[model samples]
Target: TYITFPIYSGITFNNISSYVGIQAGIAASGKRDNTITTSINGIASSENQLGNLSILLPDFGIRAGLILKLSNKLNLHAKYYQGLINIFDKETSLSDFTWRTQQFTVGIRFSIRNTNDCGTCPAWRT
Candidate 1:
């Protein structure tokens, strides 16, 4: 599991808006399941165990997305996140490759606010 903090800047034109952001994340807890399979003659067996996978504590990433304003209080959105850090522990593993993360999301957003809300409006609008 990871806890992430994202900071974004956005622009809106008509009913569409787009944003780009950077994120700082940390893994609170992690584990991996390792499966081993063996075959002897015509017989096969498998075993599974929860292994301790060492994850680098801190992570960084970039994100970009688009939001379509369906109304003042509703929107549709999609985003992509690319991990910039290799979370795998290179010191513990013999693999020569590094691991990163890529995530894609699509969702709807709902809000409870009036069109004339002062605190939530942009400075230019107020």
Candidate 2:
């Protein structure tokens, strides 16, 4: 999932103060008993458990937060993401589970167009 706050300025994208947005991501892993976990005679019973021999799982997550525009076509953004990832197979369900992983990120967006305000345009018009 994703969200954003649009901050528009009267100056046709001149300068912007701030904004807020959100995005979503997905990831996965595996759940199984440790091969090191041994049974009597030092035998690895987990291997016999056959905990989901193979796993293919998917999970959902959310993102939130704000950003700032330094100049037209150029801006910085910040956001926080929390996701619930579950790794389970047909026969594997580890009692240990995770709620979420917290994170913070910074990003920028810019344009390749040359700025006329920099006085780089043809001088003949003046």
Indicate which candidate wins on lDDT: 1
Q: Deviation in angstroms for 72 in model 2?
A: 0.9
lDDT of 2 by residue, 23-107 (tens): 3443433335545455788765554343322332443445555556666567677766555454233345443544444568888
Q: What overall lDDT, based on C-alpha atoms, would model 1 receive against the true structure?
A: 0.86
Estimate the overall C-alpha local distance difference test score of candidate 2: 0.48
Model 1, position 103: C-alpha lDDT score: 86
**What TM-score goes with each of the models?**
0.78, 0.41
> lDDT of all predictions, in order shown?
0.86, 0.48
The regions of model 1 sitting more than 4 angstroms off are 37-45, 115-126
Q: In model 1, what lDDT does residue 105 have?
A: 97
The residue-by-residue lDDT of candidate 1 on 89-117, one tens digit each, is 88888666688878899999888675546
